[model samples]
Target: MVGAIILWIIMIAFLFFILHAVIQSALDSSNMAKNIQDIRDYLYDTKREGRTDKRAVAEQLLSTQPGAPQDLYEECPACGEKIIQHEPECPSCGLRLKD
Candidate 1:
């Protein structure tokens, strides 16, 4: 009887873990979908606005941080290249980095 109870407890614990993992994965997927939708909307808006310099807009959206110096330069961790503020693509390795 004790062995069966132990087995049942283990099964329940396993199921709880599985459910938690599944729920976490679903939440992550939902968040990713929302981010993609946001990017799509931003692109559509940019196109509608007739902005010729979409790269500038994209760079602004991707890199602009409050209270940050505009001309400040940082060394890239990947290629050790000096990168300026508001730049996303690394000049050396073309790595998409968060500025």
Candidate 2:
């Protein structure tokens, strides 16, 4: 019968619609996972690159960018590390200092 044939066509169309929606949902999930993975990789690379030569790559910036005696500190003779006037020895190089 024509009615039965039409009913079958509608059922097949509905199944195709469901299949298309499932495939689209899967693709969206995959894309979101890929985006998260890329962000994790970037952070990991930054940490790895900063693992070595931390001292050499560093600068001892003063809190007030010292120009006066109040904020000034002693400098290390061996490694040029700044020593607070109150500190008896150089913290960075562990060298003894004269008061």
* Top-lDDT structure, candidate number: 1
| Model 1 residue 99 distance off true place after TM-score fit, in angstroms | 22
| TM-score (all chains, Cα) for each model | 0.35, 0.33
Q: For each candidate in turn, give its C-alpha RMSD to the true structure in angstroms.
A: 8.9, 15.5
Write candidate 1's Cα lDDT for 1-99 as tens digits.
Answer: 999999999999999999999998897689666676777787788889998774466566555444545556677779998777557878789988875
Highest-scoring model, TM-score: 1
Global lDDT of each model? Answer: 0.75, 0.65
Candidate 2 is scored at a TM of: 0.33
Over 4 Å off, model 2? 31-99
Q: Which pairs clash in model 1?
A: none
Candidate 1, position 62, lDDT: 59
Model 1 ranges with Cα > 4 A deviation: 1-29, 64-99
Q: Looking at model 1, which ten-residue stretch has the lowest summed lDDT?
A: 61-70
